[model samples]
Target: MFAPMDSTEIFWVATICVLLAVELATLGLTTIWFVGGALIALAAYECGAGMPLQLILFTCV
Candidate 1:
C-alpha cells in the first residue's frame, strides 16, 4: 500500500489530475498552466511548505 497522504497533498494531487483530464479532453492548452502550477504546489508541499506558501506557489508558478 502507498503511504498515506495528508489533505494538502491530496488536494494538490486531485487538482493536478482534474486539470490534466480537462486539458486532455479539450486540448486547448488552458488547464495545462494550472496543471503545472498544481505540480509545483505539490512539490512545494512535499518540501514542507506552509499552506500560504503552497497557495502562493500554486498561483504564481
Candidate 2:
C-alpha cells in the first residue's frame, strides 16, 4: 500500500511549481531563490519532517 501525501508536501510542491512558472514567464532570477527554498522544504517533507521543521528549513534556505 502507498501512503498518501501530506498537505505540507503538497503546499511546498505547489509553491515550487508556481514560482517556477513565474520564473519562466518573467525570464528573471527573482523568485528563483524562493523556488530553491520550496524545493528544500519539499525534500524535508519527503524525509519525514514535521510542518514546523519544514517551515524552518525553508526559511533557512
> By TM-score, who's the top model here?
1
Residue-level lDDT tens digits of model 1 in 1-61: 8899988898999999999999999999998999999999899889988989988988986
Best of the candidates, lDDT: 1
User: What 10-residue stretch in candidate 1 is worst by lDDT?
Assistant: 52-61
TM-score of 2: 0.81
**TM-score of each prediction:** 0.91, 0.81
lDDT of each: 0.92, 0.87
lDDT of 2 by residue, 1-61 (tens): 9888767767888999999999999988988988998998898888888889888887887
Backbone clashes under 3 angstroms, per model: 0, 0
Clashes of 2: 0
